[model samples]
Target: MGSSSSPSGGGGGGNGSEKEGNSSRPRFFNKKEKSICWAKAETVPGRHPERWRKDAADNVVCKRLFNCLGCLCFEYDHIIPYSKGGESVAENCQILQSRVNRFKANKDEVDTTQLKGYSCDIKFTDKELDIIEMAVYGDVIRPGNQCRCRTVAEMLGKYKSKDSTAACKLPQSSESL
Candidate 1:
């Protein structure tokens, strides 16, 4: 939050030549790094450095969250999970309903080793389905259904265009459950 009166003052050259050790100019500063954090100081006429900036692509929905039927509003939620080595990108984030987000968060806190069938469909073996009548239920309870509502269908339609391969696949039937 410090400011200097001189344009070439001792703090550091906000605008200086980067020709190695040309002068007493601070060696640490660079033009690109300065641009990223540079903000207008309210008290003065000079630029102040900041830690965060508004994203240029703020209008674009995160692809992964969009695919999961998430609205572009609010912070995105990681799908595969950052704890499991997922990266922080739109492609990895899934939009979740508030109720579902709460349920998943609570579920994560509990040990489900004794809670049989908690694994659900995606994890269930196709072979296991062949032997059980309830396997049909497993196939329907998709991870995608967490955001069940009209929003889900609308978002799914937009996402379907980009993910054409999955477009024809029928939604897992939730009627029986």
Candidate 2:
């Protein structure tokens, strides 16, 4: 099977064009966003950082295992899920092994409470947190001449600091009557 390709064409390798085609495809995350997510996942408290350590020759090797059960490999995932309006910002993104990402695909939310012995606390900037709250909990309803709404922080019973409130605004349906 492999020798047939070399014998038939043999000029430029078929693999070269295939690589170029793949390079033209759009990536889910840009370079900067990917680097940020990778950095954040590296600080998950109990995860093995050594998995990404540089080798003796100063080259880094990917040592990520299959899923949440193993060590870290780099696969970026959306914490809030894109289908649920989660933006591709750093806060909404996370790094998981390929298997873990596949297992968690497209779920609206991840129930971290059930993950025993795993202490997971992902840090988010105030603005990112606000966006998450709005996306997950903010509600808009038009009642007669006015629109009624509640912020995600309010629904979650968490107090929203004045700074956080002012930093992000909920989507306005019709000029907050």
Candidate 3:
């Protein structure tokens, strides 16, 4: 053996450091964490009418819903507000929170609705964003693991705050498209 500066006792620097690495592996998220993720993932699928199918297909549907996309039930969301000349087609419909849909009240909210009558790209609320983030990240363990869910929103918000023309013209559907 090579000349040892310190013996391999409890005070041994090399041995102590090496032993630290052998400690029990860290546990993954506990049951509560899993439940929260599952709930967040399924929120949209269970609530929205038009989006339920897509949400189910995207694995955002709750496990209670047959755990299959085909079995998911959906409803209609007005892509273009009836007041603003929107259609009720699947392409135009979306899965939205009941509260959100009610808030809009069968008409377009100028601030939330796009000018050209496309509601597919929605302005998400914080709760909605949380679910989107969870779905994209597959579990929120670290900030470094953040997904691209809000990147476009952040960029758009930033550009709009600065009144940047480039960002203003960016197509709204691009976020999910």
Candidate 4:
């Protein structure tokens, strides 16, 4: 939205800037507006058309998994930024993966080439996507066998397995890669 005026409500909520003037407009795009932003993008061929847009740095963004991290969950971005008087409407909205959006926040002058520089080049497998979904949203459907994967929280910082004995020690055998 290059012109003035913005929707009064948006679920994603703006960058939380309480600044006065044009910057004090609706920052985040609403659900309907988010969908409109997605609709404006080019879809990846042979992929789920409604769920997936064209690939960005080998990352896939699913509309249903908005705002999640790692597995390329995405958010509706302001193309021209409300802070600079950009309106909060479909024309000014663009969908960006969570990581990329965070890296590109509030910048009005970014191009597709620059987008690649701001993207993630890692490509994950289907099973990895499931694990990512589980870690981020804890909503993966495990078909059978009860396999426990460590949550990101447990994997971060200090971790001591409860299943281990009081004194846990690794074998001195160093395996070469």
Top-lDDT candidate index: 4
Which TM-score value belongs to model 2?
0.36
Cα-based lDDT for every prediction:
0.26, 0.38, 0.31, 0.57
- In TM-score terms, candidate 1 sits at 0.19
Clashing pairs in 2: 64-72, 64-73
Deviation from native of the Cα of residue 1 in model 1, angstroms: 35
Clashing pairs in 3: 49-74, 49-75, 50-75
TM-score of each: 0.19, 0.36, 0.23, 0.56
lDDT, candidate 3, 1-177, per-residue tens:
100122321110121113223443211222343233233333443243222223312323223332111222222234455334443223344433222333343455434333223223344443453354345343222223323233465666763234321211222555642
Pairs that clash in candidate 4: 1-92
Q: Across residues 121-150, which tens digit of lDDT does each residue of candidate 2 receive?
A: 333443333343334334211222112244
Question: Candidate 1 or 4, higher TM-score?
Answer: 4
Better of 1 and 2 by TM-score: 2
Which digits, one per residue and each the tens of the lDDT, describe model 1 over residues 68-125? Answer: 3222211223344433443333343332322233233312232223222222223223
Q: Ten residues in a row with the worst lDDT in model 1?
A: 40-49
Stretches > 4 Å off in candidate 4:
1-24, 55-59, 124-177
Give the winner by TM-score: 4
Quote model 3's TM-score: 0.23
Candidate 1 local distance difference test against the native:
0.26
Q: Write the per-residue lDDT of candidate 4 for residues 35-119, one digit (tens) a residue.
A: 6778877775444456567433335776666665654667677778765777767888777777776666667787777777777
* lDDT computed for candidate 2: 0.38
